[model samples]
Target: MKTGLPFRRPRPLWFVALLTTFVLVLPAPAQTGQLAPGVRGLATRAPKNMKIDGDLAEFKDAFCTPVEYFSFDAKTLRNRAVQFFYLWDDEAFYAGLRTLDEAPANFADDNHLWEGDAVEWYFDTRQDENFRSQAWPTNANPGAVHCYWTGLKGTNIQGRFCLRPGYLNAIPKIMIEVGARRTRRGMEVEFKLPWANFPDFKPKLNEVIALDAELCYSDGGPRIFRTFAYGSPLSVQQPANLGKIQLVEKLAPSLWKACGPVITPVRCDTAWTQNSRPQITGYMAIPPNHAEQIGVIWRNGHVTGDLRSGVPARRRAVAERPGRARHVSFVRHCL
Candidate 1:
């Protein structure tokens, strides 16, 4: 589903001029709450002058128990760094990200913001073993229902945008905000996600929950971070190899199917008898538009008499129609 309008490339001079004006018009930071005392050392003001090797310390430490720290040092491309922070309250879940860039950043024409520097949040209310399945059970799945916004030079440019939900096989909902200025310190983004959207689970007073967040950038690629409120170790910096995050008290067995949805059962018409040799014959049900193929499975038992018992017959069948069919055998237990 299309969420908003298509991205239009703004003229470079006009884009920069408008962004500068917008930054000047931004309201002063509200005195709602300051950075927690523990993370005061990492708090930094967005750098104004564009210096290549300035103190890259303005990026705040992540508010999420597990968050990624990125360095903005690109030789070929513009050097930029981004930091992600997160916290949860009774009413909503909050995320704050600060980005430092050496050049103006460009957003794509489509809402495909995942192609650029972006932050993604995933919440599993059910806390199922299969995170992807629990978020989206069907084959064509949408990712978690979440919101994303962008901040260019400390100014909020967009708000409460919906993300398209799907995995590798489907189109993902991605939104992009363009015309961010390059400065000594990078851009910063602050976000708030409503708990009403995630009605499946709620947090009690002082209750901590497990959550996962990811950061993607044009320079640094993708990084994943995770947190566990139950005193468990969680890390999201390692995007490709993120360990599983369990939230709920216990996970129930999955009701989803293990194998393919379409199954064709075949019944063999053969009986074992003292004098009659066991023979296999069955009609296979071919799937729509699929070619016919035969497969065979066997069980091993006590071989008191002839070990070569069906060898000759099986060989003869293969020789008669070498290209028509293929047969494979499996032995469960050694006699």
Candidate 2:
């Protein structure tokens, strides 16, 4: 059942560095175009527990918005039948896309994604009141973040978090907590972008920000792109073209039960060898770990060795090292 190492090496360094908690950036107002009446933040009352896995059950209660683009059928081709959902908490904003593709293939390693299929999400954190002043984005509003994730042939998957001036790139600058899972129909993608990642993003009640996204699908060649906004107006280069995201106030925490995976980091020794999968035991309830298993994993693909002994029931292996070890523990349905 396992998908054999989830690709070859660890993601690019730009990505691994973003795994930690984000630091909030200062707020600066930027321009947001006229929001489509339907294109507003879909309220998520409680921070619903979700994983990047291609599971739709978690999204049953979330909002499902339609996409403007789908495929290519020449004269008869209608909407592609793509849906997007939105969620936000104190820390970050979450979005998921359920795309229906008849023939899903062609996933490239680098940003040559246009050659095949890719999903694009553009954000303009500035929301500057004077956004109309600039011809396009400049260093003045550098907090804008453009992100995209890919499931290569439904087997290998990764994300590119662009923080610098560029939007589309062959390689990403940093990585965030992004996940993608392949489904029978096509592929379900999930990603989280923290407010802290933006230099000018400030979280506030009913706070409106610029946001837009789309999905690009291809059978083997050519490209068919879909957008959340009309005419696919939002682009990394044009912040003013992006739609808006209004922060919807949710009920108090007492209203709902806390759901999702509860994760904790544990340390381990480096006795394990490289390429050797560690055995984690002790806890009566074993939670599902991430595919990109932490520790002993590096670009060089080196680890000490296989784990000979299991950690205590509650204690989980966080990471492995040539001479050191650590473990991360999580409980499913913790709510």
Candidate 3:
């Protein structure tokens, strides 16, 4: 039965040397481009001269996380939509809220602001073992902050914040420059939290901090419905349940995972009615040993046709570099 040279002489050898292919799961270093694990958001660097006037002029380009999840208290969730914006500078961190509430009104002050239409922002500044602990950050815990911001009260157009109870009270009242107004679709509010409030935390590239922004709808009473930037079941009780965001120089237009034939810094925005056509921009990384020519097809859900039909699919690429290529221009039509 010795018909084969080595057909049956490999069981032991193969079992002992099964290393033809392998992969190493290594810890990822801080990267500006790649959206890494456990990092749910990005705090992009803002212009030093950004005027926090409740008008999101330059913030149109800022990173926006749609507020979709509703809290357990929401009764009849309709006609309520929101988006949270984040930006940070050396001196202060900025947050913006664009909500679609037809008749926006909040008449609560300071500690009771949560009862009215307002924002409950939870932030954890710790990067150590205590970061994102499930326990409520009481007075003993100085690693996090819970802030409630209200936009309107009576006939005045202003905003204010109530820092976490029994926490940071030793410090002076947080001077948050506020601007709020009612928009056609809903209302917009903007606030600036100076680094002076979080003295231990500094805004630096790749420095991560946990955060969550919740929007409470009052309808002239106790909060009837609410939404959040990133929903955490325990967030109402603890800062440990919030999500994390890394400080970066620029924002990633899309939250693409770390691995892939990557294309990024893509710019396609709605301006939400301000611009009918958005400039589509992207840069695709050229994998090693790939062909010099690459093609990128652009097709929105509204746009029709495909690569086979060759009617609307537009290819966008530019002169190649050592590792990545700059994307030229793409289709101009957008929603």
Candidate 4:
């Protein structure tokens, strides 16, 4: 089943203006590459009249990714399931999480919020280069984002960086719009992350990124357990290990014909890197169904590549050989 629909082109912020106006140093968007399974999901465009009130009403019809993996201490938490939602608009990336919990509370403030009942989210705006990275966060060329959101702040919704105290001070302030609603059954957390924070990234059609949402449960004493939608031990090692999701137009149930991924890399022919054999890659997006039946195709300055454990490792031919596309690894924020 296929349908034709018209979509609007994303408006660019011309982030280049920052380079000339403020002489700000922005980390270049990680070089991307094509990998089929690497993309765990697709985020359809938000409705024109969308609201971020933390209610699940707007997402009533959207498909949800479940958070099934839990920590050893939380093995009995099978009853406490979680559902994650994703949406993208021209200006930002939006995420939502809903879970069953008798006690949803977060007493910790600022950097210590992880100790309370909260959702510690991680995002990899960079494509294959840092998609499922296992490295620690760095200021020089930061590729992943780590943060915590909790609405139990009592006063209002709050979010904070989970990075080292001053690790992200140098970067521009990231304004995230977050909200949460407590229900008789559980709670819902939602947030909108603007592309402006990622000055180098201009959200285009089918632009993909890696992300995940981890649900932390405290129930008063302390964060007793945790669960992951796209589980990766992201505490400090895995940022790129988050799940892969791309921006798309109207998400239809059955669409055989659709737009392909748009993989764009920061042009850098010569790089002065600390590691050897560093590779340049391009990324492309495909419909979930066709991902398994991928056919060779080429785009400008990009080649279809492969992913091992979410990291793009080696290169493939321009248009030859039929093989399975390796899946990418899979996080979220809130208040």
RMSD of 3: 15.7
Q: Is candidate 1 or candidate 4 better by lDDT?
A: 4
- Models 1 onward score TM values of 0.36, 0.52, 0.63, 0.58
Which pairs clash in model 3?
132-240
Q: Which candidate has the highest lDDT of all?
A: 3
Put down candidate 4 lDDT per residue, 1-335, tens digits, no spaces.
42332222231223212111111221133112233455666676777666777776666434345443221234344225566677788787888777666667677767777787677777777655655667645674365577666666733444333443545642354667677887655677777777776766778877877776777787655788777766546544666566667676644422211212211111112223424343221122211112222222322222232322111121221111122222221211111
lDDT per residue as tens, model 3, 37-146: 77877776887698877786646445556443221123332335466778888887888877656556776666777777888888788766778887655654365777
Among the numbered candidates, top TM-score falls to: 3
Order the numbered candidates by lDDT, best leading. Answer: 3, 4, 2, 1
Which of candidates 1 and 3 is the stronger one according to lDDT?
3
Q: Per-residue lDDT for 21-41 in model 2, tens only?
A: 111111122122222343334
Clashes of 2: 31
Give the winner by lDDT: 3 or 4.
3
lDDT of 2: 0.43
Ranking by TM-score: 3, 4, 2, 1
- Assess each prediction's global lDDT (C-alpha) against the native: 0.30, 0.43, 0.55, 0.51
True-vs-predicted CA distance for residue 250, candidate 1, Å:
25
lDDT of 1 by residue, 1-335 (tens): 54333222322333222212221222244222222211111111222332212122322222222121111124321232233444344554445544444332325322444444555454433333453342333333222343233432222243323353333322133222222223344554555555555455565432323344555455433222222221122322211122223211111112001101111112222223323332232322111111111112112211111112111111111111212223332221100
The positional error of residue 214 in candidate 1, measured at the CA in angstroms, is: 2.4
